[model samples]
Target chain A: MTPIKGLVLAAHGSRLKASNEEVTEFTQVLASSLIDQYKHIVPAFLELAKPSIEDSIDAAVAAGCTDITVVPYFLAAGRHVREDVPEIIEERQKAHPHVTIQATPHLGVSEALKQAVIHLL
Target chain B: MTPIKGLVLAAHGSRLKASNEEVTEFTQVLASSLIDQYKHIVPAFLELAKPSIEDSIDAAVAAGCTDITVVPYFLAAGRHVREDVPEIIEERQKAHPHVTIQATPHLGVSEALKQAVIHLL
Candidate 1:
């Protein structure tokens, strides 16, 4: 039987305790909604927050997942999305060449996201 | 003559100097393009970073703007949007009842933002 893969939501972590907690909570809520096929949903950070992208990917690999999708929880396609995230993913892919690594797009202004924002407005 | 109004881009300020700088840079770019009617464009923060939202609004009021729009540079419609920001705006409005205060939506997944994200992908 083929093992089920997982999703890793990467966020630009914050040093503020409340801010980090907020991101983690959102990721947890998002992950809980998806079950059955995609079982594991992990949240990783770029800086300040714990469990960096490297750590989360390593954890996912350890949990017997052969394929992973990385979603960047960023608002813009700036330096982090343009440079930092890809570099980290590339480095990790080298280590686990067999695992299929897919880096999803950042959470920019999408329709769903726009609705969420509009609701806020 | 109707006095000029300003727009304030308020962000959840980061301690990471680079992150703050990036936000400020983006606001500057955005402000520069709107040079005709709206003159002053200021970037304020919730915490960590300097020039808090209160300070920015105060500055705008001081600078002779009779109206101001406060744009929340946040992703979700969380507590800050539902509660804190409104409270701050109310306090400021009381102080400057003559100034029209408008709080814009957060930058969620809009078509433009999505395009920006896809570009990163």
Candidate 2:
């Protein structure tokens, strides 16, 4: 049987409700685009929000995902991205050793984002 | 005589020094790319960082820029983008009546950013 893949869009949650909602909505949009590649796509928050990284990972595992990818949707590689999110991922990965859970670089470091900023101007 | 244009990349300032540096460095890269269009391109903070938006605008005016654009380098349109940043821009525009100052939408709302996120996957 083919391994079921899962994806997580990890974001730095905001105190503002709308801000968190925007990430959730965007994740839905992203999930639709990646329907073929991922059986499950979830939006997880670092702080001040629901469905945290650990919870998201566990849920993906429960959903029978054999492989998972976490992408940080942040503009900078701050402590949250560098330390907090990674720590959560590390813990979750150990808890579910059978599942291949890995994190990609945060969004800010992407060269594509730099080009996008120029295009916005 | 042509009006000298200035661009301000306004970001949500971080408490982490390295986080702030990343934004400042990105602004420099952006400035290099926009050299032909803008006489001055500066990075400014909303809070928790140095070189506040008001100061950046004042410096741009002092540097002989008659027109300025402030682009909020933020992932979400939170209180900072919707209210705080705009309030500062409004106050600064009135303070410098000779200078035309305006703000663009925050980075998150861009369709290109959505595409970029997909590309990263």
Q: Which candidate is the best by TM-score?
A: 2
Q: In model 2, which runs have C-alpha deviations exceeding 4 angstroms?
A: none
Residue pairs with colliding backbones in model 1 are A109-B109, A109-B110, A110-B109, A110-B110
Model 2: per-residue Cα lDDT over A1-121, one tens digit each: 7999999999888888998888888888777778999999999998888988899999999999999999988887778888888899899989999999998877764566777787767
Q: After superposition, how far is residue B58 of candidate 1 from its true place, in Å?
A: 0.3
The fraction of reference interface contacts (C-alpha pairs within 8 A across chains A and B) present in each candidate is: 0.11, 0.40
TM-score of each: 0.62, 0.91
lDDT of 2 at B94: 93
Q: Give the per-residue lDDT digits (tens) of candidate 2, residues B4-28.
A: 9999999888889888888888888
Predicted structure with the largest DockQ when compared to the true one: 2
lDDT of 1 by residue, B20-71 (tens): 7766776666665565657688888888888999999999999989889888
lDDT of 1 at A8: 83
Chain B TM-scores of the candidates: 0.94, 0.93
